[model samples]
Target chain A: MILGVDPGLTRCGVGVIEAGANRRLSFIHVDVVRSDPHMSQDLRLLAIYNGLAAKIEEFAPDTVSIERVFAQENRNTVLGTAQAAGMAMLAAAQRNIPVALHTPTESKMAITGNGKAGKIQMERMVARLLNLNTLPTPADAADALAIAICHALRPAGALEGGEREQHLTPAQRQWAQAAQRANHGRGVKRGM
Target chain B: MILGVDPGLTRCGVGVIEAGANRRLSFIHVDVVRSDPHMSQDLRLLAIYNGLAAKIEEFAPDTVSIERVFAQENRNTVLGTAQAAGMAMLAAAQRNIPVALHTPTESKMAITGNGKAGKIQMERMVARLLNLNTLPTPADAADALAIAICHALRPAGALEGGEREQHLTPAQRQWAQAAQRANHGRGVKRGM
Candidate 1:
C-alpha cells in the first residue's frame, strides 16, 4: 500500500492505493483534511499534522508519496503548502515509512501520457485508472491519487538505485526525455 | 523563559532566554541543530523536529518564537526554510506552547535600533545585550537570540490583543505603518 499526500493549508488531500502485479491498482481510501482559515496558524498546522499522522497509523502504508510544490507568486500559499508538506514528510519519518516525491508534471505524464494535461483531463484519467464510478471530489484528492500512481509506476531504479539509465517503456522514455527538456536550465527543484 | 528558533535546513539556530521586568533579560542557552545535507530530505526534517522537541522538553520554555521567512529567489532555500519553520511551529503546538513569529527586520530593530543593521553590528549588539564575553559563534545563533528579545520586548497587546491600533509606541507605530506601505498591493503574508 502507498499513501499520497497533496499538502495544503485549507484542505489537504490524502489518497491510499494498493498496487498489485502487472500494474493492477486498487483504491484504499481518498479524503481531504481541512482547517478553518480563521484559526491560528499553529493550530491549523497541528490539525493537518494530526490528521496525517492518524491516517498513517490507521492505514499502515509501506511508502508515502508527496507532490513537489514550486514557489508560486503568492507567498502565503507557498508558506502554507510548504508547512503542510513538512507535516506529511515528518509523519512518514516518525513512523519510519519511506517517502517519494513526484512533481506535478511527472504525475500528469504518468497518468495521461502528457505532461501538460489539464486538471479535468487528469481527474478523468485518475477515475478511469481506479475504475471509480465517480470522480474524486475536490481536485486536490485526485491530484494525490495521481502522485501515488506516478510513484508506483516509476522506473525500477529511478528512486533508490544510482544509475545513469534504466529500463523504460517507449511512452515512459519519451515522457522522461520531455521532462528533462522542460526542466533544462529552469533550475526547478525536483524534490526535497 | 522563551525559546527562539532561526529555522534553516543546514543549521537551525536555537536560543533560550529569561525575560524580566524593566526589559532586563538573561541567556539560558544558545546553540545550533544541524543536519547533514547528504541525508534524505525526510530524515533531515526528522532531525530538526526531534532536536527542537528535545529542547522544548529540556528547557520548558513558555513560548516558541520563530523568525518569519519570505519567499526568496532560490526556491530550494525557501522551501527548506519554510519546512524548518513548520517543524518549529509543530513542535510548539504538540506541547501546547504559544508560538510567536518575528520578522528579520523586527529582530534587527529590536536589537540594534535599526531595522537594516548589518550582520556584524547585530551580533555586536546581541553580545552587548546578553553581556557575553564573546560573540555567539555562527551568526545564526545570535539571530535566534535577537528574535527572542524582539518578541519579549514587544508591547503586550501587539501579539495577542484583538485591537492592535490602540496600543503602539511612536516607534512601533511608525514601523507598522512602514511595513504596511512596503507590503501594499503585494499580498505579502504576515506571520501567523
Candidate 2:
C-alpha cells in the first residue's frame, strides 16, 4: 500500500492505494486535511503535522508519495506550499517511511499518459484508473490519489532522474534503505 | 534567557540573552545552525529541525525571538527561509515556549536606534550593547542577537501593530496563551 500526500497549508490531500498483480490498483482511502487560513502559521503547520502523523500511524503505508514543489508564480502560495511539504516530509521521515517525490508533470504523465495533462483530465483519469464511480471532492483528494497511483505504477528509481531528483538528501536515501529492509519480510511487495 | 533565531535554510543564526534589571541585556550565547545546500531538500530541513530542537532542549530559554520573513527579490531564497522559519517556530511551539517575532526594521531600530541601519552598523551596535570584546562572526549570528535583544526590550503586544501583524494565525494565538500560562510561575518574567 502507498500513501500519497498533496501538501498545502489550506488543504492537504491524502490518499491510500494498493497495487495488486498485473498492475491493478485499488483505492483504500482518500481525504483532505485542512487548516483554517485565520490560524497562526506555525499552528496551521502543527495541525498538518499532527493530521498526517495520525493517518500514517493508522494506515501504515509501505511508502509515501508526495508532490514535489517547484518555482511558482505566486510567492506567498509557494512559501505556504514549501512549509507544508517540509512538514509532510518530516512526518514520513520520523516514521522511517520511504518517500518518493513526483513532480506534477511526472504524476500527470504516469496517470494520464500525458506530461501536460490538465487538472480535469488528471482527475478523470485517476477515477477511471481507480475504478471509482464518482470523482473525489475538494479536488485535492483526487490529486493525491493520482500521486499514489503514479508511484504505484512506477518502477523503483524511476523518479531519480528529474529536477525532483535533486531533492533526494542523504538522510532520505538512508530511510529508503531502512524501509526497504523493513518491507522485505512482508507478503505485500511494494511496487517501488 | 531568550533565544533569538534568524531563520534561513543555509545559515540559521541563533543567540541567547538575559534581560537584566533596568533594561541592561546580557548576552549568553550565539551560534549558527546550517544545512548544506547540496543535500536533499528534505534532509536539509530535517537537519535544521534537529539542530533547533537540540538547542531549545539544552538552553531551556524562557522565550524565542525570530525574524519575520518577508518577500524577497529571490523567490527561491524566500521559500527556503519560510520553511526554515516554520521549523524554528515549530521547535519553540513544541516546547511550549512563547515566541516573539520582530521585523528586520524593528530589530535594527532596537539595536542601533535607526530603522534603516546597515549591516555593519547593526553588528557594531549589537557588539556594543552586549559588551562583546570582538564582533560576532558570520553576520547572521549578530542579526540574531539583535532580534533577541529587541524582544527583550519591547513590551508584550508590541509586534501586533505592524504589517507583520497580518500573518498571525489562530494556532499562534493559542500557543501564545499557553506560553503565557507556562511563564506566569517562572521568576524570569518574559520581556514580551
Candidate 3:
C-alpha cells in the first residue's frame, strides 16, 4: 500500500492507493486528520499523530509517504507547521514504518502528467485515476491520495516491504533509521 | 560547530556559531540566501537547496539546526514554504548529519527564560548570551543562531551520530515509509 501525506498544521490531506497498469489503483482509503490550531503546539502535534495512528492501525499499510517540511513567509507560522510535520514523521517513525518524502511537483506530475497542473486539474485526475465519478471531498485529502499513488508507482525497491517494525535491536534500528532518513527523498545528489 | 538555518524563499537566513564552553557564540559567520519568487517552484527549491549546501560547505559545521516550517492563512504561501523546508532537510540529510528542528516557543525559551517571550526579550537574551553590545542585525540571523543553541541544549538524539554508519546495510535503507496515505495536520485533520 502507498500512503500519501499532504502535511500542514491547519489541514493535512492524506490519500492512499496502489497505482498500477492503465492508472489502476487499489482503493485502501483517504482521510484527513486535523488538529485545532487554537490549542497548544504540542496538543496539535499530538492530535495529528494520534488521529493518523488510528487510521494507520486500520489500514495497516507497509509504508508512509509525506511531503518534507516546507519553509514559508510568516516565520512563526512556519515554525509551528514544521513542528507539526516532525510530529507526524515521528508518529510513523515510532511505529517503525518506512516513510518516503516527495515534493508537490513529483506528486502533481505523477497524478496529472504535468508538474504545473492546477488544483482543479489534480482533483479531476485524482477522481479519474481512482475510478470515482464525483471528485473526492476536501481537496487536501484527494491530493494526498495522489501523492500516495505516486509513491506506489515509484521505481522498484523504493518501498521494499515488511522490514520496519518495533522491537529491533537498538543498534539495528539506528542503522535502519539512518538509511531511511537518508533515502526519504529521491533525486538529490549523493551529498550537499 | 553549530549551523543555524532560518529558511525562506526570498531570503533564507543562515548563522554559524562555534559555541565553546563558557564563551558566548560570537557570530562565526552570517549569510543570507536570496531566491526569486518569480521563478518556477522547482527552480526555487533548487535555489534553496544549493544555497544551503554552499553555505554549509563554506562553514563546515558538525551540526545543523533549523527553525521549523510553518504555514500562513494563504494556501499558495503554505505550498511554497513546504517545498523550501523539504529542500533544507534534503541538504542537511545528505551529510549524514541530523537536522535539529526547533519550534518558536523553544526558540524563544532558549533565548529567554519565558516560553511566551517577545521579540525584544529574545533580542535582549541573545545579546546577553552572546555578550553583544546590541541586538544582532537581520533579526532572522540572530533567531537562527539562537535556535542552534536551543538544539544543543534541548535534545541530542535528533541527528544520528557518525559512529553508526558501519552498522547499516544497503538493503535496509528503504524502511520507515508509511504505505497508508492519509492527510493529517493540525487544525486540518478531519474530513477525508
Residue-wise C-alpha lDDT for candidate 3, range A1-192, written one tens digit per residue = 777778777787777776554335777677888989785443455567567667666766777777655554356556555544544554565566666776676666556656688999988877876788888889879878877876654433232544433433333244334446546765331111
Worst lDDT window (10 residues) for model 1 chain B? B153-162
Candidate 2 lDDT score at position B185: 66
lDDT tens readout by residue for model 2, B34-112 = 9998866667888899999888898999988888876654666877888898888788878878787778876765665
lDDT of 1 at A169: 44
Write candidate 3's Cα lDDT for B129-153 as tens digits: 6677877768777777777766544
Worst-scoring 10-residue span by lDDT in model 2 chain B:
B164-173
> In terms of lDDT, which candidate is stronger, 2 or 3?
2
Model 1: clashing residue pairs? Answer: none
Q: Which one wins on lDDT?
A: 1
Please provide the root mean square deviation of candidate 3 (C-alpha atoms, Å): 18.8
For TM-score, candidate 1 versus 3, the one ahead is: 1
Q: Which ten residues in a row have the lowest lDDT in candidate 2 chain A?
A: A164-173
- Residue B4 in candidate 2, Cα distance off native in Å: 1.0
**Model 2, total clashes:** 5
Q: Assign candidate 2 its CAPRI class.
A: acceptable
Ranking by TM-score: 1, 2, 3
RMSD in Å for all candidates: 5.0, 11.1, 18.8
- Candidate 1 lDDT over residue span B1-192, tens digit each: 989999998899999989775456788899999889998889999999999899989998998999987886477688889889999999999999999998888877666667898999988877877788898778889988888877776644344454764545455455555555556767545556
